[model samples]
Target: MGLGAGRPAATRGVLARVSTAVVVAGVLGLAGACAGGGGGGEGGQGRLAVGLLLPGGGASRFGQFDRPLIEQRVEELCPRCPAVAVAATPDPAVQRQQLESMITRGVDVLIIAAIDPKLLRPSVEAAHRAGIPVVAYDRLAQGPVAGYVTFDGAEVGRLQAEALLQAMAARGKGEQIVMMNGATSDPNAGWFKEGSLAVLKGTAVKIGKSYDTVGWRPENAFVNMRGAVAALGGGSIDGVLAANDSLAGAVISALNATEVRPLPPVTGQDADLAAVQRIVRGEQYMTVYKPFKPAADAAVDMAVALGQGRPVGSIATRTVDSATTEDIPSVLLPSVAVTVGNIKDTVVKDGMYTIDQVCPPRLRSACDKAGLTG
Candidate 1:
């Protein structure tokens, strides 16, 4: 039986009454219907139609963890609910179309990790017009998004920058570093760069070169890193502040291609499996582990609640203002900096990945040295 099937008729009756009151109040337009009357019948007992639009699958996290975690949580919360998920390949146009399709298909709520928030505003507004609440997941999308769930983006950059500075400081002062930021279109990229600059500014580290990677693609990062290497002179760069693990991997690859001896510290986020392996092997410096479970759980909770015409105040503890919207309910989770020292405590302890999963055959020796037992 479905989740709603287990509920007593009396509970359904109460929900029907509340839904009627909500409709009379005319709070959320079509969204109010989604919460109350749109699902099954007069009793408001039916499966929720949820649409999940992820930015891309190139980032291993999106496919390997986030999608599954969110789907599982949504099923647990609303067994009868069906979640339609799609990856946009980092194309804003494709994402917009996907959003439109979901809206037209009558999805009760949308969880979007926008490829380009600005470009998706019109689609988001369209969903709003249709009375479907949108929840901004990970990346904040403009328009009347009902709620947001993500880590403190600026702090992610601050953590990466601070760790890079510390690593570079060990070599001596007056270091020069390259900044490989995410795509310019991503608002989180600007926030990350701002936070990183806030720390990098007034410091001994010289910003030798910076590039806003197009599409946040590894290839773009590789090309940019190569250019930075050429401009700064090979092996002269001190460290790299890569926006995420993918970029960090590309930067590391570029450094390797240049045969830069003693590769400088490179900072990343997402704590991707490869990045974690790089850290164990002493190739990458550190990564910011933004625990996706909490974020995913929050998004699922918010989506289910909003789909059922319930309030999101309890789920969203804070409010954030976007370029197009203000006082948007948000749940910004904290992030942790992961190095070889705490691999066990962070990813392993949290069961994000087993030690064996992270410590592949090639990385076994390094894993053992890092005190990570399989």
Candidate 2:
């Protein structure tokens, strides 16, 4: 359900004072420092100086949902004290540079989704060494991240596993499926796999083949799916447990290329529009709808709380630890399983997407059949 991003490092208020002359170089195209007053650009002081970094390149859900929703919520909470700076780069090195830049610019708090959680450990340590607060966004940051907000990734896997099981039941296939897990680099991937395996362990189900997706890359999924088909025979693949919507899309594309007309049940997450549409058409069996608003809102609140030197415990409902801390403040958001039956109740209700946008001409009939009326 999530990925990593990066951020740079700089001192807090004290370092900002001496680094005033270097704010330009410090922001790294982000924005100027606010230590000298009126230098923070469109977003300023008394406001929360927050740094937001997303894991992928342009055209990702991080920018679409994580960045704006986070910025919006921050503004709503502290109109005067909310200043969010966003930087997204696909390269982990570039992300590391971004994280350092944010810290150098003196943001009160840093919120990140690591491009590589373990690799970013040094950066997280740098943030802590500088006394900067970090909130692990969506995935664990592995350092001394102060707060965390994310869905139970294990739950994400469990949902997909359960959905795959049900889909298998519908097809009257014996309990066996191929697993399409995410990249091994991401901590969340491991959690999701663990959860899914937990469900499949003693069940009647048997895993035919499984691949740990590289970078959670769709291409990798395609390659893996192709291999699965080659090994098991196209018709033998009873179900696919794709980790996310993107991977699910790849699996479906491969199955289509192989000319398996009526594809097996495939499970996905993120409740992406395409996945939802696939479900409506019966190509994909299910997706996990994580109401992103609440997660975004929680991040916003955590960022603001860190910015204002306020206690984040009020907004946090749970606690989790990474390598550095025993218990970091956290918000473990719930995830809902979205099949053809309830896109309206989850994402549409959460305003993640509009019914009209989702019910395009190609999908209009399917949408109607699924009860997603305009």
Candidate 3:
């Protein structure tokens, strides 16, 4: 089921109206703050402070896109509002401390991409107690979050599985595949696995083995893939459903070590620079391109709204239920399946990456074949 599948229309309409009013009030307050040199009276006016706590730097997207985009958007929307960002490096304990620090320091709002949703519940609850609104970014952090922003995670999994199935069509029925899932702590990982299972289960493909990489670490994935190769026997595996590009890289590295001829097709996500290059070189099959701009923008919008003590119903169209929070306002963006054929149309055209950025000198020939050249 989708995030907001069962909400009544009447409630949605009411939330929309509330959101519109909040937005207007927020705008007026922003103007007042600027005029007064960053200080206002009611409705959370003045210089707003937003805290951005990311999971880690493991995934390239967090640093390459999410942080800068969110910071830039926060500046653009509320120039007086300053966003303070910190990376937790996938440690829930460290994230908890960071949350406590942010709360202690008195940030007006927080945007958290949790390392472990359940583990961070207490911290989230602490933030709530302090009257600081939390906006869950990319991951659905448990607890009382004011809002959430992420891509359709289940669709991401379905896209990867569907692409893998197509790539493995020649192998046909009874083909063995290994599932290299992300960290189990991440809710998105479960959603991805669920969506992929929806496509791969009961089909011609047989799940030879599945491993949830701890902390979504490439090194851990490397170890897991190596073990899978040793146990399943090299060249026996048909395809690999890598949760994202980082894991795909590790899986590919493992396959390379075994010297598997005609390497099996692998699926990935995040469209990381290295992953895109892998696709160009035919080392990886495909990736799910989640345009981060919209998601980041939505998070910033919601952060500003919440910081200003305004409703986010207009910004967050959908409502998602978490382990502790129900009907939480959310903005779930769409994702695109990117193959070598459309790298230019998806990432390049969107200006997420330039031709030169993705196409290196050594990859020129491959880029030409993929039509990624100037």
lDDT of 1 at 256: 96
Off by over 4 Å in 2: 1-47, 80-83
Error of 1 at 6 (Å): 46
lDDT of 1 by residue, 1-374 (tens): 10000111111122233322211100111222333331222322455667788866645678777887876775565454434354444556666666777787787788898877877888899999999999999888888889888888878889999999888887774378999998877778887888899988898778999998887899999999999988898668989999999999999999999888789999999999889999999999999999888888898778777777777787887888887777788888999999889999999999988988988898888888899997
TM-score of each: 0.86, 0.86, 0.87
lDDT digits (tens) for residues 1-374 of candidate 2: 22222222321243233333321111111122222221111333343456777785346767667777776665555445435556776655667667887777776678788877766778788988887788888988878888899998878888889888878887799556889988776778888888899988888877889998877889999999999999988777789999999999999999999887569999998888788888888899999988787888887667655655567777878777664566788888889999888888878888888998778898898888888997
TM-score of 2: 0.86
60-97 in candidate 3: lDDT tens per residue? 57877887787677566657543434444555666666
lDDT of each: 0.78, 0.75, 0.79
Residue 280, candidate 3: alpha-carbon lDDT:
95
All candidates: CA RMSD (Å): 11.7, 7.4, 9.1
Candidate with maximal TM-score: 3
Error of 2 at 294 (Å): 1.2
Number of clashes in model 1? 2
Best-to-worst TM-score order: 3, 1, 2
List candidate 3 stretches off by more than 4 Å: 1-43, 57-59, 80-88, 170-174
